[model samples]
Target: MDKVDIQASNANILKDHGSDNKLNVSYGGPKIGRYVSASSNISTGYLLLSESPVGSVLYKDKCGSHCVYCFSRLVAGYPCEACCDVAFCSPICRKKKKASFHQFECRYQEFLTGLGISSIGRLALRLITSKPFDYFLKIRKYLNDTNETLESNRSLITRNLDVIQFNAHEVYEFVRKDNQNLKPSKQIAIGLAIYQRASYMNHSCKGEPIFDNYGPTFYFKETKDRQKELKDRYWFNCNCQACQENWSLLNDLISIPKESLSYNKKLKQDSFKDLIHFIESNYVDGKMPTESIVRAIDKFRTVCYNMGSVHYLNK
Candidate 1:
């Protein structure tokens, strides 16, 4: 997926829950149900929302080569000036990282490395030090209110993510593999992030035409047993059209326009530029003409596959 540089402060549409119209949420036990808001009805490949991580941590191995704060590749960027261990993409990030949680981590990096602390342990340590005792105490006053979102102790800062196994997303730094001059590197889990909002229905949609970017999960099983496997693995079933109607797999697929895309087709050298033109022509006022978004994504996916980019976007 193409990453957009956006911040809540500057993005006009993100202010004051303005973007909330794109999603609908219902309290359905611990697993809250979320779908596209009927009123907003986003086209395919629409961005739902952007979230700042409540708490995040880099794996021990990534501390030196990658920015511990932003997780960007470390260059002549700022390193923990004292310890010279963990690095950051910029001096600004280094300053913010110090204030956020790195000041504490920097002090004990050597001690913690000796203990061979795991990434999860490092993240837990970050949580423990990221906030002060008074912050927790202040939130304690809301425990009695049923209307309070989540009144637990961990909820003091961010909603409790105690059941982390069900929510934490492993982040990766993937490079575009289509280019020959770009050096290919081993794909590794660099860090983990917890968004206040949860991952949604898009994930479990059946019969995805593209590759799965969320890394490998289970095998691409048949439609009959896929739902059961998804439920058993993820503990929830999706309500996407593909899942509901039991759409056939990619091999038995029909292209978007039934004439434009193909599984085995190769695209021209200027296909990427053509994609930009298509989007410029079709994507207007933050929305694409109905079903056109699907065509756009499908065409992009087809080009990426032909170019030998890491196939990870499944449907």
Candidate 2:
């Protein structure tokens, strides 16, 4: 056989294909091999396991509050649930990486569910709904019209939940402890560590992580003194606009009950008048209304309003 055929035959022979490892597993998109063995270049006894980020959120770095020109938000259009939180594709992955910052947010997983959103999906919705120009315009207007000092505005922003600040050392340690049982190379720590190599990412004042065209290979650095350096190397340390006021936003979000926002059952049962208009205006070619689509539009409009898009579009 030719080289191509031989290579194909070898791959077929070695491929796990339908093995238990492959079946009923939480695989998404494609699988990337992990780094299991210790590297002499950075050995420190901690068994290191590295793999590309998965799910929509962290794989895409959709965590944290808002940035004025958050490219991910513009693209994905909502708060990124998966990226915002270190969501794993499988329970095994989640259990393996639980020691990281995810522990802090995992407690609030129910809140995320209430919105019927995933981290990446939320980011996408926010982006789809945002009007960046108008958002900036409002920012300028608030500055021009109000006599508030820069510090006061900053405080207000901080209180509003535009940004999110976290303790990186705690997050790092959490992951290390949580994944102790997993195979050395199969463990993940932070959202950033999900990649194989993490040197290429550039920090942004208004950007989120991106992974297109390239196969997954981003990873967090395996530092010997991880907890010590974590504070310094954390993705965000300053009072960036997103974290300053993000808590308030989170509070506001939590105030709303999930059942109040749900449409799954009611959409099938109720027949409201505006539902018809919504279907005619926003749906595929204004086809006859279905309860499901109407409910979807309602949910979309709520998301648009929350991300400050509805007002932008109105203007």
Candidate 3:
């Protein structure tokens, strides 16, 4: 199948919140329904959750960049004063994340308590407050009701807390930094989360490393990986076709070149379909083995560095 077909499939899976979305389940008596916590370490509690040993590492890197559609951004609209230093779900996760984003804003806990916000809400408040002052300036205009709005906002924050804190920077700088040795795909995944949270990066039709589903899990891999790496993988996890056409659309936003972008600004923008055709026809090497495919994937890394909406967007 082509990239569009693959991405639409992935997006649908997430919207449905299938089994993969239910990472943890507590068993109860057969008579009683199992209490499922949508807010957990694995599910990311409206906040971007990371797998790094340091709690919420991805969160810290992208804390300053806020996307309009981001869960954290909406939650941040409320002041999460109570749970500034606490994790949203469990005490253990709270303790693990104590030193993360909390250290800087923990003192603001009173903001939550006085406002009747929950611990989770408090954390969200802390995150927004920690952002550039401009964020608050933008919020102030939309705040509407101070007393009622703040109260309701606080209520939402306290629910669905994570076990880990958002502090991933202090895990030792060396440890927190990206591991260069990881497979390129894994590294891009980490970067993707970071940019998604911080920058309003755009997508491209000619993008590489499309996001796809291998049955239960979501993945962003080089197009060439389709034959070798993705052979056994299922195709339903992805719903974003743009993602299927070019996973690097995100990475390029982070790595684009200063000059090429200016030149691209003057050139005609490529349509998604056109880009998809270009990538399939010009980039692919059917005769070469895995190494050749890998090489082409690496070459496309420059796409991230190219100047275009795919690399940088404010909203």
Candidate 4:
């Protein structure tokens, strides 16, 4: 079938099955992929994919004052009278969370706290309790029907369970351990949430569009990483451009020579303004050229670097 026909068929099937129209799970470039792109013509750098959490959990010790539902940090929040440990930014979030998943977990809060299970494990538990067994059966059937090779294993349910059990590990953040110590110790994981579509994103130490979480909506950025942590924990080698080229090679490719352009204040100001406007306009709600956007951003950074303004590049 033609690409248009195939997409139409897929959409019809999803609509028939009562799937959320916002989510599109299909087979393509990377086996089974979740995408926000409706067509190949759509530009890159657009906020393409987004999914609400299937399950989420807050850290028992950390984020105590943050809303259990939205993860909003509140100076003062509406406390859960039953658990005493949880709080919400507003009554609406509290009500929604309780109706959706918190009702199942509220009574077991103490037990979960004592178990010291990783956030993924707790999220898994929440998933099981919040969703009916028939839900997974439907998901499995849908996946099989889609003919996506990403989940070709016969024991799909078992594999998902295994992912929850083994793949989920504790995440740590650097924090001051003691007042006297100049160096910081790694603090324990503060929170975690599972998004079915979000999990499908492949790893890249230098993957384009960098992923960042604001509440539940994730946005992308470009940065450098060794992928050592992801490899050790998630067990995958990233093949993204940054990973493949390494920082030195990638830098060389995008860098502008110092002699090419003299540091003209007007040129610098205009270029920066144009680049920022283009990104904000094209990358926010509409489609964008993924490679082109990345290159433009990199070139802008290179220009700033060549002008001997290292700090301005990040800003």
- Across 179-272, the per-residue lDDT of candidate 3 in tens digits comes to 2221222112111112111111111122222111231211234444543443443222333543355434223323333342222222123233
Per-residue lDDT over 1-315 for candidate 1, one digit per residue giving the tens place of the 0 to 100 score: 233333322223333442454444332333443322223444444444656666788887777878888887775767678787788889899888777776667778889989987666666667677786678898897556564355555565443334354556777665444444223323456898765554432321222211123332222345557667657756766454455666554444443452442222333544676665555444452232225444455565455444431322221
Ranking by TM-score: 1, 4, 3, 2
- Give the TM-scores of the predictions, in the order they appear: 0.59, 0.17, 0.25, 0.53
Work out how many backbone clashes candidate 4 has.
5
Candidate 4 regions with alpha-carbon error over 4 angstroms: 1-38, 41-44, 132-190, 203-227, 249-255, 258-273, 276-315
> Between which residue pairs do clashes occur in model 4?
43-288, 44-288, 44-289, 210-220, 210-221
Summing lDDT over every window of 10 consecutive residues in candidate 4, give the lowest-scoring window.
306-315
Name the candidate, 2 or 3, with the larger lDDT value.
3
Q: What does candidate 2's lDDT look like per residue over 275-294, in tens digits?
A: 44434443344332333444
Clashing pairs in 1: 211-312, 211-313, 211-314, 212-312, 213-312
- Note each model's CA RMSD in angstroms: 9.8, 26.3, 18.2, 11.1
lDDT of each: 0.55, 0.30, 0.31, 0.50
Per-residue lDDT over 151-260 for candidate 4, one digit per residue giving the tens place of the 0 to 100 score = 54567545655665432333333333343432233333556666654453331122233332221100132323346544555555555544454433322334333343
